[model samples]
Target: MSTAQPDEGTDRATPDALLHTRTGTEVTPEDVVLAAGRDVTPKNLEWAKRKIETEGVAALDKLLP
Candidate 1:
């Protein structure tokens, strides 16, 4: 039996972007609280703000990586 391989140089079609996609990379306090599995209450938001201020970039890096 013989088999054929796909063309390596062929260009594949890229999928269209979602209709309601977020365009910004800006991370908000809500993102932190939500990522930590906590409710988005006023106190939690305040804590997130302080965490961001103290940790600086580490806050987002910790959540993502």
Candidate 2:
């Protein structure tokens, strides 16, 4: 007789999980704008830049996590 084990090699991602994977780490201004539900325009990019400058790492954390 042989025992079969569950397969853990392949991973599955839910829609919510996909959002995190797509973003990953290494925050970008475009990411910030999108996370904040804003369009990726030049003005939004500049705003995101200032946000990153002021908040640093916390910016992405606040937006994502």
Candidate 3:
């Protein structure tokens, strides 16, 4: 006879859980702006980078805040 074990690897933390673990100061507008420009889509990345450079970190509000 064999015993079945539950799969722990299948479970992953939700966004809320991830957020809770973050340091409040780490989620600043500057980080948001940089992240926005890092998309894999070439067009979006170019556009985002330009937006960040021209508009500054405030533009990240559309995506982060």
Give a tens-digit lDDT track for model 1, residues 15-35: 543332223566678877876
- Where in model 3 is the C-alpha error above 4 Å? 1-39, 63-65
Output the TM-score of candidate 3: 0.36
How well does each candidate superpose onto the true structure, as a TM-score? Answer: 0.55, 0.58, 0.36
In model 2, which runs have C-alpha deviations exceeding 4 angstroms? 1-24
Question: Which ten-residue region of model 3 has the weakest summed lDDT?
Answer: 20-29
lDDT values for all models: 0.72, 0.80, 0.55
TM match of model 2 to true structure: 0.58
The positional error of residue 14 in candidate 2, measured at the CA in angstroms, is 17
Per-residue CA lDDT of model 2 for 1-65, tens digit only, reads: 99987689556655653454234467789988998899999999999999999998668768864
Rank order by lDDT, top first?
Answer: 2, 1, 3
Candidate 1 deviant stretches above 4 angstroms: 1-24
Q: Evaluated with TM-score, which candidate comes out highest?
A: 2
